[model samples]
Target chain A: MKHIKGIFAVIAIVMLSAFTTVSSGYKIGDIATDFKLKSSDGTSVSLSDYKDAKGFIVIFTCNTCPYSVAYEDRIVALDKKYKGKGYPVIAIMPNNPDVQPQDNMEAMIQRAKSKGFTFPYLMDEGQKISPQYGATKTPEVYVLQKTSKGNQVKYIGAIDDNYQDASAVKSKYVENAVDALLSGQQIKEPQTRAIGCSIKL
Target chain B: MELYFYTMRIVCLLLLILTASCKNESRQNEKAVDLDYNEDFSTVPLEIYDFEGLKPFLKTNTDKTYVVNFWATWCAPCIKELPYFEQLNAAYSDKNVEVILVSLDFPKKYDSHLKPFIKKNNLKSKVVALDDNDSNTWIPAINPDWSGAIPATLIFNKEKRQFYEKTFTYEELETEIKQFLN
Candidate 1:
């Protein structure tokens, strides 16, 4: 009876730890895991493909999220401004199409075309990518800096201080992080928070 | 006679100010209740709240445990898990649990989309609209772990506070409530 109780306790502890690892995902300074996902252009995209990229602005955004829609133009603008500067914006659609039918591949392609996106808008089908980065919401960003070992996440959070209005945005978070890396300066603010639609699991 | 005249003028001035203040107070009270009283019973009262307005609703001084669920009309998972919240509210009415549905629906959609959705669903729990334009500040203030995800729930009383960023089944929600209740 005592041995059975000990076995149960051990099982419970292991289960609890596993659950925690799954739930509480990546934090600041953690190395981001690479993923190969289908882009809206029908090509598979991965961070490793960007050979010249000093870093990547990996944004998990979708067509259906109001917050994502609000930031779409800004995302495009960011990619245009920074792609040549060695940091390219890679937008990922992290929502499940079954839960959000409007966020499917067809819709993603349409949205990208409509918005004139310069970035590769990837679709994270089955949501295999966002979880590793700890992305819980649409328009969430993980600014990764390429190091000798791997890509270490320098910052994580919103694109800017304002998601409602692009013109009204006072702070551009992704821009700041990328600029800091380009200039070999420390990122003053490593993280920010925003309200966005939860990535449909 | 002069003193009497002066006193009468002062009294008249005071009375006028008093009446004006009273009228303003009543108008404000009427405006506050108008949404609830004027609307149909099926249509839930939806008030826009900033972080300041939303703060008190999170951590309450009262004994009632508030199960505040952040949701939107467009969010499918939120819609899926809403019935569970409604059921919990219904079942635990006698208990100290209070359910509040905070809708993060767009301001423009309040009339065209959200109001109608609430009416169509006949959401029984207290519903409010959070219209904070700057999400960067309030998301972390609400809970450090929250990524500003919808279908997220904050269950709290005076003693304990728990924030969940994942969707809930009816049973899962009940178990969470039971854990907090204990």
Candidate 2:
């Protein structure tokens, strides 16, 4: 009876852990945690860096993914449009250089410089931050609204409906979410999805 | 004569899948931008689809177990695991296990890049492209858990269905698919 009970307990524990591990990342209205990561410009950046900010456009993107590259210009435009409106774009490279050397910090610096990015392109060293937000792909967006509670994950997903061509885009999920925050209105689309390269660990 | 008929039937089924992928004009035009693709793939009959067109493949009401793997030419990890899916298809096709390689390569690369990669690899499994731009809609429709990342997979039969958002080894895939087998 003791041996049977011991076996059952171990099985239950294993099954419980297996179930918990899959249900990670943030959901809508969830209070997001903050992190201080190194930026391409050699300065440390965090969500709290912007004191007068209303919210943030947190994008988990990398230099290597074509999808990320395709959205690079649009991302820059987003920063230009919203930074003055109290919402700034904070780009994070979540891929490990070991897996994809193109995503190394030096390349990140080069990419940001060449693109004339007006945002902080930070590297998520040790990959501690992406998992917390549950970002699975490059160019994944999390629009976080700063509140009395903490930074709230307001909207999550793609930059727009048309990733192939910026001109053809109909819906810009990140922009819409941030705009909603600025207007003191509820975000219509709290979450969305877009095809992106799997984050290289 | 029986063996010949069986082979013919298999060939016809393959043909049907190819033809079913013919363009859905209305939906295609809405998402079509100014980008152009090379029509150099005269030999490669790879069917390109929006998520709406690709939906039927995911919900096949068949007796055979189906393994649909989402991959792309640019994704290194997806390419690394392509052979495993091919191997699974070869090893289990006779056992009523079918593998479908769903390529999520960009629409611009469908003809220029994906076709060459398929030919170079000499892929045996049925290959198709999901060219859907409205990913936010279809991504969750395929699986609410899927974060719209490539190399995700779906294995199903009439009795059970499973979706994986992780890389798979051949043995690991075999082990998972075996549970649905007799």
Candidate 3:
């Protein structure tokens, strides 16, 4: 009976590890593959479209989430400040249209227009991109830099330390990563986490 | 005759002061009763905390099972699963189980959003507000499996601790609780 229990324990451990590996998304330094997703402006947007760009600020955001709404201005500010420095923002709406009607293509277009977004608000149809990046929440960020290997994910997580008050934010995680890349310096903090609404199925 | 009249005057003043104090006490008691009946029962004062202050809630070090739920007013899924947790809290009081709802609402929205929400839902479980700015530090500390998603839960006792980054129905929650029910 003891030998049988040991065998069962090994099986359980192996299955748990396998499950974790299947669920985890991209890690830092992983090469992110490009996607040609549809944007709110009736245009196809892809990472490779920006030829002169050094990196991309790929953020997974949606319209309905209050957390996402709070960060819209900050995300816009990131694009405005960093776009001129070769890191343009590429925001994706990854929630299922069925679960979140507010995040549909029509709402995405209206939100982008009203907010004067200086970036493309693309819809991740079929919700494919977020899972690849292992993004589980709205307002999650991934900063990728173009390299000889491909677009290398330099940073993954929140925009800053404080989600509620941007001014009160101490560590600008995404900004610091992009700035380091521009100055040819190694990024200090490569990953961060923030509370956000789960991507609706 | 002069001494007698002075004593009478002093007695009158004392009576007046005593009646005035009596009226004030009754009035204050009336207001307290009114507040209890008033439909405005949302006066549940929240226990606000930063990351350091919030850490103790997780490590209660008691024999009773602790069901700590991380939720926000804005999270739809979290809101949906709340009633189950509330039911478990109410039904399992004698079973040595406790449920705590940790609100992750923004500090700015505490007055306008979180408080009103607690009142409207009539949440029976003890609700506390976690307004910590450093989420990156605390999110992983809660559980490495947590992807900073709402509707997450932590169940623990003296022997074992388990965290879930997903929603649960009453049956599902009770099943997990039963494991610690020795």
Residue A59 CA displacement from its true place in model 1, Å: 1.0
Evaluate residue A58 in candidate 2 and report its C-alpha lDDT on the 0 to 100 scale.
Answer: 92
State the lDDT of candidate 3 residue by residue for A1-201, as single tens digits: 555455556556555544444445677889998999999999999999999999999999999888899999999999999999999999999888877777899999999999999999999999888877878888999999999999999999999988778888899999999999999999999989889888775
lDDT of 1 by residue, B74-173 (tens): 7766777889999999999788898999998878778767887778778899999998877878887887666677768899989998888777888988
Between candidates 1 and 2, the lDDT winner: 2
**Model 2 bad stretches (over 4 Å):** A1-23, B1-42
Q: Is candidate 2 or candidate 3 better by lDDT?
A: 3
lDDT for B173 in candidate 3 is 92
The regions of model 3 sitting more than 4 angstroms off are A1-21, B1-42
DockQ for model 3 equals 0.19
Between which residue pairs do clashes occur in model 3?
none
Task: Say which prediction, candidate 2 or candidate 3, comes out ahead on DockQ.
Answer: 2
TM-scores for all predictions: 0.80, 0.84, 0.84
Instruction: Please give the distance, in angstroms, between residue A177's alpha carbon in candidate 2 and its true position after superposition.
Output: 0.7
Query: Which tens-of-lDDT digit does each residue in A1-201 have in candidate 1?
Result: 555555556556555544544334566778889989899998999999999999889999998787898888888888989889988999999877876678899998998899898899998988888877878788899999899979999998889987667788788888998899999999988988887777766
Return the top candidate by lDDT.
3
Candidate 2 lDDT, tens digit per residue, B33-130? 12234456647888888877888898767799999999888877777788899999999999999999999888888777888788767999999988
